[model samples]
Target: MKIYADNAATTKMSPAAVQVMIRCMEEDYGNPSSLYTIGQKAKETLELAREDVAAVINASPREIYFTSGGSEADNQALLTAAQIGKKKGKMHIISSAFEHHAILHTLQRLEKDGFEVTLLDVHEDGLVRPEELEAAIREDTCLVTIMYANNEIGTIQPIAEIGAICRAHQVLFHTDAVQAVGHLPIDVEAENIDMLSASGHKFHGPKGAGFLYVKKGIPVTNLIEGGAQERGKRAGTENVPAIAAMTEALKEAVANLEANTKRQLEIRNRLIEGILEIPHTALNGDAVKRLPGNANFCFEGIEGESLLLLLDDKGISASSGSACTSGSLDPSHVLLAIGRVHDVAHGSLRLSMDAATTDEEVEYLIQSVKEVVEYLRGFSPIWRDLMNGKKEFIL
Candidate 1:
C-alpha cells in the first residue's frame, strides 16, 4: 500500500503544474530580461503568473515579488520590515516561539545586529494567543511576524486577529504562509497582512518557486543582488517555467480549496481517532484548529526514527516533525514548545495527507502504525520500565 502520507515535506506536483512547466520550458525559454519577442513572451508569462498569484491572495500584482521559495521570501520580508522600522527608530520585533527556523534564525541574526525580539508563547494547544501577542508589542515594535500555520504540529494560527492587532498598533505584520497558502483561504487585505511568505511545493507545485507579498508602498530589501529582475529587488534571471507551474498549481488548489479541506478533514480525523485508540498515544495540537491533512502524535514508548523506518518498510511514509530538521537527532522543538517531554517528543509521528489521500490508504496507515508501535514497544526497555512502574508515563 505505498501510501505517501508525508505531504508536509513536499507534495507530488499536480498534472496541470507539470504540463505548464513543460510547455514553458519548451516554448517560453527566453530570458525575461531581453527586449526580443521571445523574451517579451517569457516576460508576459511571468507577469501573468504574478497576477494569478496575487489574485488568489487578494493582493495587487505589483505587490508580489517572486523568490526562490518561502525561506528567501521570509528573509526578505523580515529584513525589509526591520529596515522600515529602523528608519522610524523602531527596533523591537514580536513573533511566536514555534515559528519556522527561517523566521527564527533570521530573528536571531537581527538580535545580533541590535534588534530586540520577543517571541510570544504558543500554549500547549499550539495556538498563539492574540492578546498575549498584543501585550508583547512595544512602542518600538517594528514587525510582528508569525506563521499562518505550523509546519510540524499543523496548528492553524489566528492570522487575521494577529494581523489586526499589528495593524491597530501600526506595525508591519508578516506571516510565513508556506503551509497555509493554497490550502487555506487567504485575503491579505481583509486579514490586514503587510507581508506574506509562501512556497509552491507545499501546495503540489514545483519546488524552488515562491513569492513574497509586500503590500504596496512597502519597500522590499533584495535578498539576491545582481540583475534588475523582479523589479530590481530579486537579482538573476527569473525562473519562468517554475513560476508558471506554481501559479497553475496554486490556482488549482485554491479552486478546490473548500472541497479539498472537507475531504482531508474527514480522512485526517479518522486517522487521528484510530491512532488515539492505541494506549499511551496523544495527539499534538488542538484537534479542531489544525490543518485538515495534518495529524501529529507522540507515543509514550519507542523512538520516532525506528517508527519511521518500520513504517517505511510497510510502504507508509511519515515523519517525526519538520523535514528540514529530520536529520537531527534532537527531538522536534515544536513538540518541546508544546510541553511534550523529551521521551514523548522522541516518539512522535507526523502524518500529513493531501486532498487526494484515500480512506483505504488511511486505513492501511492506521493498521501499519498500530502494528509498528506495538512491535517496537514490545522490545523497548523504556516500555518495560513504564509498564513495571520504574519510569512514570507522561502521555
Candidate 2:
C-alpha cells in the first residue's frame, strides 16, 4: 500500500539511465580534459550528451553549459546577467514573488550588492500577469527572470509572452525551468529566452547534474573559477557519466512527453477532485494551467507537518512545501504570495504525481487524506473554536 506522491521533489531514475551511468563509471573513466585517446573518448561521450540535451529544447549544443545542479545553474544565470547589466549601467531586475528560493534568494543578495529588484505579485491562481512584467520594466532594467513552472504549486507561467516582451525591450530574460524542462516542451529561440536553467534529478535523472542554457552571443561571466572547461563559462572536470545519463533520461522523457503528461494529468485531476470534496479544503494554484502532475491543497485547522507525518505512517510520501524549506516553521512564501492566510497556508499539502502513478494509488491517497484531515481537525483548537462561534479569532 506504499504510495509515493512526491515526484516533484525527485523521481526514481529509470533503469536505462542507471545502466548507462554504471557503464560509464566502470568502463569509461577517462578525464575529458586530457589529450589522450581515452580522454578523447570521454570527450565524445560528453558532447553527444550535450547534443541530446540541446535537441530537447531546440537549442544549439554550444548554448548548453553543464552545472552541478539547478541551484548552481540559477546562480550562474543571475550573477552573469547582473554582471552584464552592471557593464551597461543597468541595475534594475524583475521577477515574480512566487519563484523558487533559488531565484528569490539570489535576487535578494544582488539587491544588497546594489542591484534594485522588483518582485511582482502573483494572482490568486498562482500566476503573474504578463502585463505586470511589461509595466515593471524600466529603461535601466537589466534582466527579467521568471520560472517556467512553480515547484511547490505547479503553476506554469506565461514564459513565451514574457520572453517576447523582454525581446522587444532589449532586456535579457532568464527562466528557472527546473520543474518544467523535461516534463514540458521548451524552445529557447521561439520563446525568446536569453538564458534558462534546469536540473536532471527533477526528471528521473541522477542528482548533482544540470545545465544552464545561455543563448549564443549573449554576454555571460564565469561563476566558477579556473580552467577552460564549458568554453571557460563553467570550469571543472566534466562529469561525463552523470551528464550522459541525464541526457538519456531527458531523451526518454521528451520522447514520451505527450503520453506521460496525459497520464499524469489524469491522476492529478482525479486526486484534486477527490481531495477537494472535504469541507474547508481548497486547491492551491490554477485549476487548469498547472503542471500535469501537481495537486496542492490547503486544509483549514491542520498543520501540514502533522498531516505529512500521519501520511508517512500510512506509507504515503508527500510534502507540505518545497523540500528545500520544509524544515522551516514558516508558512510557504508561495501560499502567502497568492493571498493565503497564515493559518491556512500552514496547512498546505503538495502531492505531486508522475507518469507511473496508478489509479488505485491515487484513490488510496484520496481516502487516506480524507481520514487524516478529519482526524487532525478533531483535535485542532482552531476548528473547535470556529464550531463554537469564535469566527473573529480564526483568521
Candidate 3:
C-alpha cells in the first residue's frame, strides 16, 4: 500500500539527484566566492549547473539566478518588476486571483506601498481567458504576473498567449512556474515571458533550491543586496551542492517529459473517471486542459480534512489544497475563484500524481476514496439531512 498522490506538494528526491548532491558536498566542498583552487572547482560546478538549468528552459545561462526556493524567486520577481515599473511611471500591475500565495502576498505588499493591483477572476475551468487579461491592462499597467499552472486544481493557464499580450502592450510578464517548469516544456523566448520562477523540489530535486529566469535586457533591481553572486542580482554564498543536484533533476525531468506526461495522464484519467462514479460528486477544474498529473474533485457533504485523515489510515496521501495553506481551515481561494460555493469547496480533494505513480496505486486510491467518502457521509449530519429531503447542505 502506502500510495502517495501528493506530488504537487513536494516530491521524493531521485537517487541520481541525491548522489550528485553527495558528490558535490564531499568532493567540491569550497566556497564559490573564494579565489582558491577548491573554490574555483566549486565555481565551475556552479556555472555548469546554471548552464544545465538554463538549457532545460532554452534560456541563456546568464538569464538564470539561483534563489532560496520558489517563494523567494516569486517574491524577487514581483518586487523587482514592480520597482522597474515604478521607475517607468507605471504603478498598476495585473494578476489572477488563483495565483499561489507567494505571488499574491507579494502583490498585496506592493498594493499597500502605492501600487495598483487588478486581480482577475478565472472561469469555472480554473483558467483565465487571454481576452480577459488583455482587457485588464491599462495605460499605467506595467507588469502582468500569471502562473503557468495552478498548484491546487492543476489547471494550466494560457501562458504563451498571455505572454504575447504582455509583449504587445510593452508590459513586463512574469510567471510563477514552480509547478510547471520541469514537468512541462517552457521556452522563455518562445513564450515571450520576461521573467519566470521555479523550484527544485517540485521536480524531484532537493528542497531549498530554485531559480528565477529574467530575460536579458529586462530592467530588474536586485532584491538581495551586498554581493556579486548571481551577477550581483542575488546575494550570499550559493548552495553549490543543492544547485548541482537541482540541475541534474531538472535535466532528467525535461529529458523524460513526453513519456512521463503520457503515463501520468493515463493514471490521472483513471482516477478522475473512477472518482466521478461516486454519487453526489463531481470533478474540479477543466477535464481536458488540466495538468497531466492532477485530479481534483468535490464531494457533496463531507469535510476535506476528515476525508484526508481517513485516507491516511488506509496508507494513502492526498491534499485538500495548497500545502502552504494546509494549516488554515479556510476554503481554497482558487476553488472559490472558480465559482465553488463554501460547502462544495470544503469537501474538495486534490490528488496529484507523478511519473513514479502506478496503475495499482491509482486503483487503490479510487477505491480507498470511495470507502472514505461513504464512511464520512454516514456520520455527516449534512449528508443525512440531504438524504431525508433537506437539500440545503448539499454541495
Of the candidates shown, which would achieve the greatest lDDT relative to the real structure? 1
- lDDT scores of the candidates, listed in order: 0.94, 0.93, 0.93
Across 308-351, the per-residue lDDT of candidate 1 in tens digits comes to 99999999889999999998999998998888889999999999
Worst 10 residues of 3 by lDDT: 386-395
Rank list by lDDT: 1, 2, 3
Evaluated against the true structure, the overall lDDT of model 1 is 0.94
**Tens digit of lDDT per residue, candidate 2, span 1-395?**
99988988998898999999998898778999999988888999999999989888989999999999899999999999999899999999999998889899999999999999999999999999999999999999999999999999999999999999999999999999999988999999999999999999999899999999999998778888989999998888999899988988999999899999999989988999999999888999899899999999999889999999999999999999999999999999999999999999999999999989788888999999999999999999988987787853423
Return model 3's CA RMSD, one decimal: 1.0
Q: Residue-wise lDDT of candidate 3 within 162-212, one digit each (tens)?
A: 999999999999999999988888999999999999999999999999999
Cα misplacement distance, residue 75 of candidate 1 (Å): 0.6
What's the alpha carbon RMSD for model 1? 0.7
Give me the displacement of residue 285 in model 1, in angstroms: 0.1
lDDT of 2 at 118: 97
